[model samples]
Target: MHALDYFNARLEATISPMDYVKAKQMSPEKYFLIDVRNGPTHVRSVTIKDANVIPEQELQSRLNEIPQDKEIIVYCWDVWCNTAAKVAKFLLEHGYKVKELTGGIAAWKEMNFPVTNSDQGNNIPDNCGC
Candidate 1:
């Protein structure tokens, strides 16, 4: 099977960028946004507003930091990146409700969603320079 097929077969929880936006707008409290990128990449790139940074390498050990009640939505750099899927799989196997964000942060920006960076302003540029 191809990588996409494998991912599709193995994962059931996923949220589209538009759907995520709607959820955030309709009820921001319903889910928790998690960025699974490493620290360096996270620092260089823009992230969704209010997203929690839990690098994929540390996610297993840091599972305790995530709340059990809320749905967890994970994202990485982009659709090609598998980190988000891996994190979502780990969370699902661990009995936490989870969803991988389709296309990751890049897709979010492509859809004109809001993002922030420490060095940059509140709204991330459309190009992102990622």
Candidate 2:
């Protein structure tokens, strides 16, 4: 497929960070958040509350761990990164509901949403603990 075609296709599968925040606030149970950044980066960076760390390279192997019932929202570093799109596409092809976070973590942070950084000793929010 042409580059534009690929870009357009991925755009259709993405959710804006603001929209995601609304969804998360209105119905947190409807979607699962996935962080597709590599381990070291993930550890150093803050992530959306309750997001699961599933780096892109390990996603396929960890497929069984993700629930099929909820929509999955994947994010990487920022808008310039396409890792989330790749993972979203893979999940969609595998029959799982998925969407990419339009601007990734950078956008999320820009919106002033809550995030937890393990390196900073911040309390990581747990879905079950909420």
Query: TM-score for all predictions?
Result: 0.77, 0.77
* TM-score attained by model 2: 0.77
Over 1-130, each residue of candidate 1 has an lDDT whose tens digit, in order, gives: 8999978864567889898888888997889999877545435467788888777776778889999999999998887778788888888899989998988888888988888774422232233222
lDDT of 1: 0.78
Which window of ten consecutive residues has the lowest lDDT sum in model 1? 121-130
Cα-based lDDT at residue 55, candidate 1: 71
Q: Write the per-residue lDDT of candidate 2 for residues 1-130, one digit (tens) a residue.
A: 9999998876778899888889888998999999877535434367787788777777788899889999899998887777787888789899999998888888888889889864421233322110
CA lDDT scores, all candidates in order: 0.78, 0.78
List the RMSD of every prediction in angstroms.
Answer: 6.3, 7.0
lDDT of 2: 0.78
lDDT for 96 (candidate 1) = 88
